[model samples]
Target: MVVTHRGAQAVGRCLEFGCGTGHLTRALVDRLSIADLALNDLVGDCEPHVMARLPAGQRARFHAGPVERLDPEGTFDLIASASVVQWIPDHRCLLRDLSNRLEPGGWIALSGFGQDQFGELQALGSSASAPGYRNAGDWAAMVPQGMALMATRQIQTRMYFPTVRAVLRHLRETGVNGNAQGGWSRARLQKFEQDYDAQFGTAQGLPLTYDAVWMLARKI
Candidate 1:
């Protein structure tokens, strides 16, 4: 989605939120001719890692903290985030603030999870997931009047695990369900395995769903 929707666009200047080791940062440099690029993340160390991957001549700036705490102080040609906004608790106003940082004809590209993300875990009463979960239309509705939602889509992906234990391990490692941690008694563990198998089991394996939402909007 990033490559297709955001990669080909013209970018005079760009700002990235949640750069986190430069996954999207790498994509931006690989695809856009950014006159100047700014990468941001709470961890102060992301700058070096991202810069190491870009060409030597790419003009760049780095801000190392929550975006709200540090302002880059200029409108941008593009503002982008990938699989990051789901971590934010107030996505409506947060997105509005991000849109406000764009030039009139600039673009905003983002990917987050839908409300149905991790349905099985949600059914099991885990609060480990992100609080701000909205679908494509919900995002469109929240977009400010001056912006236009040029494209949006949500996809539901299921990942299967060979065993319920493996499923729990995956969540812990990925921090998908930070609340999934526990020292279950043998019986408690057994019960959880049984219930999960009975409810969502398949011949292939146990399934965990990812409801990915991707959008590309323009500040008209």
Candidate 2:
């Protein structure tokens, strides 16, 4: 969710999709004095936090829903997203829609995890009978045929923890461990933690690896 590049520095409207808890949105509002700033997320509860973080008198609007449901009135100069797009079931249609909505020469900056992200956790999930994880190559293939790719990079980050309990706590606070289908049973939870520890825990502790992909492109 870092701003890897700053283009022309022009004053125009900017939109951020999937601005979770306004972390990146606040950064953009502080850095760019644009005519308008729009923030959108699938949930509505983020409005108050986003409002508080924005500077006084900045033109701001919040949209709460799936991206396809958003009916933006006009084209935007820049459309950015981070750590969010991978969850959508139909990313291709979403990207095509974004391309259609962007003005000519407008930029799209997106960052998300690849298949290698949380490989150990994924292995554990697979062992438990869950499936369907996408990698960076899967996302690239979903991009429409004509979009011009400006840049792409994948970085690996490994977080070492003192114990498996600490790792699980981090995931819980981050809301990264929830199952979309339903809640887990007590026995299932115990088994999952035990399996994870048995397979990946080291004498030093546990190591969690995240393979993140950052991409920038133009609508053309």
Q: Write the per-residue lDDT of candidate 2 for residues 7-53, one digit (tens) a residue.
A: 54764878898887888787777766778888898889988887788
Question: What's the distance in Å from true for residue 150, model 2?
Answer: 0.6
**lDDT accuracy of residue 95 in candidate 1:** 68
Q: Which candidate should be chosen as best, given lDDT against the real structure? A: 1
Candidate 1 residues 1-220, lDDT tens each?
A: 5456555766888999888777788878887778889888888877788778788898888898887665997899889987778778777687689888889888888888898888887887655478778888888777887888888999898999998899889988875555677777899888888888899999989999999998888888
Task: TM-score for candidate 2, please give it.
Answer: 0.85
In model 1, the worst 10-residue window by lDDT is: 1-10
* Residue-pair clashes per candidate: 0, 1
For candidate 1, give the lDDT: 0.82
Alpha-carbon RMSD, each predicted model: 2.3, 3.0
TM-score of each: 0.89, 0.85
Off by over 4 Å in 2: 1-8, 126-134, 137-139, 180-187
